[model samples]
Target: MSENKNKSGVGMKRSGGMGGGPMGSFAGPIVKAKDFKGTLKRLLGYLKPQRVKFIIVFIFAIMSTIFTIVGPKISGNAITRLVEGMIAKYTAISQNTALLKSGKDAVIPIPSIDFPYIGNIILLLLGLYLISALFGFLQQYIMAGVAQKTVYNLRKEVEDKLSRLPLKFFDARTHGEILSRVTNDVDNISTTLQQSLTQLITSIVTIIGVIIMMLTISPLMTLVVILTLPLYVAITAFVAKHSQKYFAAQQKEIGELNGHVEEMYTGHKIIKAFGREHDSIKKFENINDRLYNAGWKAQFISGIIMPMMRFVSNIGYVVVCVAGGYLATQGRISIGDIQAFIQYSSQFTQPIVQTANIANIIQSTVASAERVFELLDEIEELPDTTNAKLIEFPKGEVKFENVDFSYKSEESLIKNMNIDVKQGHTIAIVGPTGAGKTTLVNLLMRFYEIGAGSITIDGVDIRDIKRGELHNMFGMVLQDTWLFNGTIMENIAYGKKGATEEEVMKAARAAHAHHFIKTLPDGYNTILNEEASNISQGQKQLLTIARAILANPTIMILDEATSSVDSRTEVYIQRAMTELMQNRTSFVIAHRLSTIRDAELILVMNKGSIIEMGNHNELLDKNGFYADLYNSQFTGANLDNEVI
Candidate 1:
């Protein structure tokens, strides 16, 4: 029986598991780069508002590229000039010797040339180089500034969209995956955006300028260089297309790994109690293997790009030398021109290779962009209406009329449920496992919308009210208590910002938690570990109650509030709850029937429908579902328990 029960509990659809669809099960591994062009254009559109800064940066980039192009040209010219001067001197000497040998020794005149032009050319080249360096730095500085700003706003926008999304969105994504997008993926975009644009623009411009210069010097050589470009471009595109899919997959796998590890560590005690260490290890290894394979695949494709490009570049060099040398020997091109063409070919090939190499980063950036935008484009489940207005709670009356709900559309969790609680009334919902108690609470809070019918507060539909204002009217404590890592003061103050220390203590006292807290070394100043794991379960629940009490809401919903405590602690909590719910509308869902005898209405539900409804004794007389549950939960108990 115990084994069957455990199996059933494990099979209970694990809450907060990823939903919607399976991840990374595409027919083909790579998503085409063309598919993302529109997203890239949309991202670039964000720069429109900063057009002035963009233009300034553009101007600097052009200037830098011009200087970069000029550097190779100047150096090529210097080489040609030096070669020409040597040839000229050698030719002069040969002619003078021939004149002397021919016995026409009439003092051979040597060609004298102007020197200022050569000096001016050399000086011009130096000046252009210095200017290029200055503009390069300026361009990089401005672009980096813009990239940081763009990323900052982009992250802020994603965060805002996430905040507006309904709870179901979070239910479908792991916390680590979402965090990676907001932090890791966003950081990748910023880093790549900062450096890639400036480098890409400069390399492209420089490559174009060098090719044009080569064409003017020797069109044949230029054609040869152009022929080699297609092969490099094709290879880069292919590798990038494949690498991007793996890169995106790699990121997703890392997120899954993080989430899996977090779950294992957080629930280590439970796993140990069940002796599931080997099982957990196998599970972890599977996720880790997927991550490792994805990472290696991405890096392998990226690694191939540079070496392949360089090999193609070398082929271009061999072709240029053969073609250019033939032209120079045929007297169709001067030696100086041939040398200059060779220099320009090298210049042209280097940028193409560099661009091909950097394409890896560009692909990764695009992949990150795709992931980020995918999140931004997610259709929020239940967006609040634009015209929704705030409706203040008069007396905290709540009613559900013919309500129906389904967590997933195929199966209903709540079915045609009708419930009403008057102002200042206490209602208890008792049901077998898998009944709709939690679903009812979810609908009440509007975390999800009902499939049919409506929920109202004081006769006004909840949908007609702003969600924020509607939720502000109630305080809730769930079965599993969650506390963030923070000082006790911060956690309690989360209920009401600007709550005084005295008010915090008052609420803590009201929850019957003050005595234990005071015994701690630092009291309110003591820091809690993640999930407050160091604290006892009773203490955690009490702290949760203190938070709700501090909010001072008109309506309170407590689900299994004292389920994890000892009898003494349960009694203490019960007393505190009595005081907290005095003259306030309240709802309780508890397995402990003794906890709700005083409730004005007690509902006994099974499957997805209510089977019984009444006050305590009236239901006991009926000898139905409610009576059976009450007797089973309170039989042979202390005499006080029977009365309670």
Candidate 2:
């Protein structure tokens, strides 16, 4: 399965691996990142460009919070004024005379209720809120831009990294594992940056500002807030520490589940053919149950933080309320300041509640950030030398000079292999599976560099040639054909950049594909489904051949190109291959010896050595490994003759 399915463009590598495993690794509880702080610091480095914008946002956030903080104090003053005015009015009416304005130092006995004063104060309060709202809106708007731009760049970086990653990376991991990093992990970072980042900043500022406001109002009341602080810290720390593991476990299970689903969906035909639907369902149930256990545990654990914080906060609120009322009676604090201080204390706990909630979010974000960074830190393919020359025109004179290689150091697969092919010569490589045929192809193509010596093209070391120019010299038709979900014409045209319709038709005719293609519902305009499953395997192979033919390269690689076709169709394909290989160097890797019997040079390989080399008759007379392989195809006839 491929991590990313071939869309129109981008991320086009084929993925490898089966899904699921025993109860270990992913099944184990989630562990912390090895360098949590480093991962977070690196994650923030992506947003470094938005530093100035964030600063502005921070300033606006503080303005909004400060405005909100003072609103309660103003409200308290308005209430106090109302009480004093009502008392003075009652006193004046009892004296049976018009209320008089007293001296500057004396109290003003109210003649009428001070409605205008209260209204003015109310308007002032509204004005402060309006300013807060304006700044708050600006803060969110700026952060939104900052968050989006940051993730956009991060996505681009990951895409570029995927393109540079070595094949070995894909070989070791599943499509699900890679896809999880791209989709789930990147998305987690995106969500945290966009939603939680601004909220976190605001929460911290609000907590600090509220603390200062409460202290300024009354030191005695501040002590009450201080008393309840330890309980809040203890509850938050304990719950957060325990919930972190479950959140990490949840992410891992989700990846496993995704991997299993992608595997099952792509291989449903094979599963049904084998009548393993029940077994597949059972496997799915196992994964799904694990996910449920991990997910709910994470959710349940994080779920307790808010309620627990609210419980702790409520207890503090009750204590402050009692303390404030008593202080008001003792005249140590005015009723207005007492009211303001209580409101300050209430707002203070909210940010604490928010911070606690954000801590759980941060736990998940860190787990995901670590996954994303791992992909970013993957070892890239060695870069080409700065002065690597471009292959202006390839002559197709290829040589493997004492080349040695292995997928691992302990196990040598190919050793001291040497072969030479002149320009325009046809070289047929015949071997069984795992005989290093594909490995040899990969070396020649520079997909895997030789461990010793060199593979050269036209006397130029391939490593010294730029990879893009090297690839352009050859056309390939592999055993497994790849066709995107597009019209048949588009798939055929993919081999050559901007190929004309006439050229596509001509190539198709040469490959004997034009006849069947014309018989289809819409001819070349027919759209292939994903996986090209709507067409037969032979038809897909024919399309791939047509694509390679359209390229008109100086070198060709055909890896079992006709294996899927019937004998009748194979004849046409062989003829097409003969014509395509004319005056061009071609490397044909085939298991069927009969197809390549007429080749100019046959390199018969077993294990990784060319044990026999000759034309058909020459190899047959040798009676070596090559002859035995060719003769084994007719064992039934031999058995019949012996019995007679």
Candidate 3:
């Protein structure tokens, strides 16, 4: 994995894999023939579970093809019988007239064929039609069910993969793009499989049936029909190849467009505050333009396919009509035979057109499949290790041993860092904006890996411990708190699934959030919107703290937990924090040095290196980085309110 070399900050870590060169460095987007084969193999693998339904539907399709062929033939037979009967009746009248004019009683021999035979053939044609229609419905229903079920399973698998993947994956990619894959791309696959696969199957079957019936009627005529096949194949193949590329490009642009839309909505407040609505519109237009052009190209190519196929089919029909007429005129074949040959030839070309339509669908589907496979193939960070086991962190002793880390190989964010927290101790980490303070906690949480050294819990390497077992020990309260769109009670209980109502209320009370929650009309049942935007930042943080407290983890990490609250709320929050940290291993990062004056250990960091370390007053007495920072910044920050 390649890391970003040209960035710096405490929270500058990439979200997915380690930074690497361009993902498709050696191979480009054009899928090779072998690649297509591999994709088809995987797609077919999804069908294993639906094999029984597949076999049933396929058998019905074959029966439907037979009925389709038989129905047209019976129609031709009915027409032939009606025509022959009319001709025979007319000849008899002519002969009778000639005999009577010669002064003799004309005796015309009447053909003994039953006229109702034509009606029976017509009835038989209707029966065949009914059969075809029934099977068509069966095939459609079964195929649609298979497609939907396949898509459901596929989406679930991708969602699970996303959850298991490291946070870094989300950092590099836009949420909209990922959403596009799961929703839009998967929908495309469903449409293609349900609709196109059915048509393709029927077309292939029709092609075979037509050839067999045509050859049985006239080999020469069948050969003439076969001659037109190459033209349809050439046109469809050319259009399919071109259309696939454009379709793939179009889908890619759609993902990009979706990404932009999601970003715009997510940052709408920022854009409006800065009066950048026009700028957002222009940016959206740029992506919309790309999507439009790609769509236009794909549609243009796909449109040409049907017209071109119909033209070739028309030419084949003409050839069969002219040749069949000539054969009938010369008495080389019966009128019924000639008629059947023409009908068969026409029927044969229908599949060619059907095949062309299926080609368009397959092209579009392949594009979506490619995008979905790309995400599934992504490398996950922090793969589970063999022999990893859960650890018993009864005391929550955290120790950092000569830890070093960087967002990229070319930049080092933390150098030879070391820290340790005893059971039930509070350690304060104070630093400038880019001094790797947050990066330290990120490593300890195993959000990112250390370039050198290790983080240990209860004297065991965290990397050697199961991720869930290790993370279950700590509860984090971030400065920017996030609450889902749910009731207050539900949000608090989210930290501990299946938590009782009483437990949630007690945690809320402990965090000093119960009073405000009680004032709301819905109280603990009040539903929040996205990110809890309806509530004040302080309330949100307190709710989050309540959630963390409800989890009852052995270790607690507070990142500027009280920064958003007012001075009046800050004291209450401080008291809550003190109570929460008591008898629990705690790490605090604060801009206000006064908040950490009673901390058991204080580490002052500068440029990824710890410049001073001791208890709060001991470092202040030393008059080093800690003293300079406190006197210049935090000391003057709260003096007016006497917050210290």
Candidate 4:
């Protein structure tokens, strides 16, 4: 029942892992990888198939950065030509003025500025920027395809891994936690690969290219710019180290808050019935407060990175300007060279900042990758035998011989159990809450492997039959009905593939569900929501019963199948089940002893062992555990809470 509640949206929110915050903020909480190098190497393996595309991306990225980097140097040269041309004109005019003032009857010719040369430089600069932009577009376009394909393959593998995993694996984790890995974590990896990885490549290329250009203009100014690298590294490392815990806390709090809300929403009726709205609100507020503290502190600390980098950058600018002015005055560097070196310096710092930002993003991405890998690494169900057998025509005769089973190695449950049921027998199993009633059915269906001995159908070991073939021999209607978002006809037809409309309607009539289904506005076409909560609980059970009837399996397992319906509806369901179970094997787990009195054989189980086995009247005559249980049900006692 708790598992059913969880499935109804208890812990199913997709918390987008980490580093999701305000826009334009370079800093996000970093999630460090447990095995950073190993995870990264594995993540890169996904890209190996796209190696050619990646090489093209790298080449385009470098080409684009190189073109942009050379622009500043070329513009600087234009500045030098303009400055020299202006000076030459000024000197010529001064000499002519002096000669005219001296009355020498001679006038020197003044030179004109070289506007054509400067125009050509402007056109050249425009061409360089245009080419750079084109290359950048291509790089991004190629990288996007590579990233999407890689993520697609990854998602496919995770889905396949999930199918192969055993039921116990899902039993141990919350739906939300597993969903986070599949959706949010995988999305995180996708975002990084598509955006951050390309940005990392370009930033590194820009940094290297800008440094070479700056060196060509002035090594002294390049050295001054390089000196700020240590400060940038120190500031980023300090803030990242200090803010790491807060970001982790922020992520944890977000998950808790989402979980609380999901729980409250799904169980809102129960909470209101119990008058615990105040308690729920208090818990929500407490989680919200912790989230607020962690969020702001993380944002504030990581937010310090950009401004500190900018401040350090400004200081570098001031030193470079002063040094460049002196060098220009000494005729060691031209005016245009000074201008280009300043541009190169600014370009250099920007990529460094971007590289640092991408570093944080990559860390979070690798952490997401590690989580996905962990899911992929989980132990899967044991494979079927190589020479598996099939039951061409099943008789539904089942026997459990010297069987032993336990969920845990240290504890024994259902030890040395044995049962024999001929075809067409209705076997009713009654027990306390934890008496392994459901476990017995699960083992019979091969939902779990037995620890010892064997379970066979028609003299053949169940393990020898392929699981799919074995499952086709039985039908089940559990107490907690599962219905996906679909029309009534579709839901019913899910039991038997290629079932026609006439067949579905026939099954619905047998389960006594057709009358109510016809009353709905859309009748058989009415769509169920995700939770299938649009209909009453009894109606949902009827639909599941209709589905099972359509299957017409050789064996049936009913686990409290009629527990959710009202007495009237339960009578209809009981009639339907009786007809369905006629001349076929059936195992019914029931708490209401009245329902199973007509069963061919009754098995009274306590502490995982069958204490009594006989017909209803024989058990009553014996006056043993089965008789006591039957009498207690009439005395209005809760059998689930009874110890004996």
Q: Cα lDDT of all candidates, in order?
A: 0.77, 0.79, 0.77, 0.86
Model 2 stretches with alpha carbons more than 4 Å out: 1-31, 86-113, 241-257, 283-301, 357-377, 636-644
Q: How well is each residue in 121-156 modelled by candidate 3, as lDDT tens digits?
A: 878888888999999899989888988898888888
> Candidate 3 clash total?
8
Of models 1 and 3, which has the larger TM-score?
3
Best by TM-score: 4
- Please, what are the lDDT tens digits per residue for candidate 1 over residues 268-309? 899999999999999889979997998888777777766886
Q: In angstroms, how far off is 51's CA in candidate 2? A: 3.1
lDDT ranking, high to low: 4, 2, 3, 1
Q: Report the lDDT tens digits of candidate 2 across residue range 418-442.
A: 8899999889998777778888888
Show the colliding residue pairs in model 3: 2-19, 2-20, 3-19, 15-167, 15-168, 15-169, 16-168, 16-169
* Model 4 lDDT per residue over 312-427, tens place: 99999999999999998898999999998888888887778778777767877888899899999999887789999988989999999999999999988998999999999999
Off by over 4 Å in 1: 1-41, 87-119, 180-193, 230-264, 267-308, 322-340, 353-393, 406-416, 451-454, 634-644
**Count of backbone clashes for each model?**
0, 0, 8, 0
Query: What's the lDDT for candidate 3?
Result: 0.77
What shift in Å separates residue 462 of candidate 3 from its native position after superposition? Answer: 2.9
- Candidate 3 residue-wise lDDT at 419: 86
TM-score of each: 0.80, 0.85, 0.80, 0.93
Which structure is stronger by lDDT: 1 or 4?
4
**Candidate number of the best lDDT:** 4
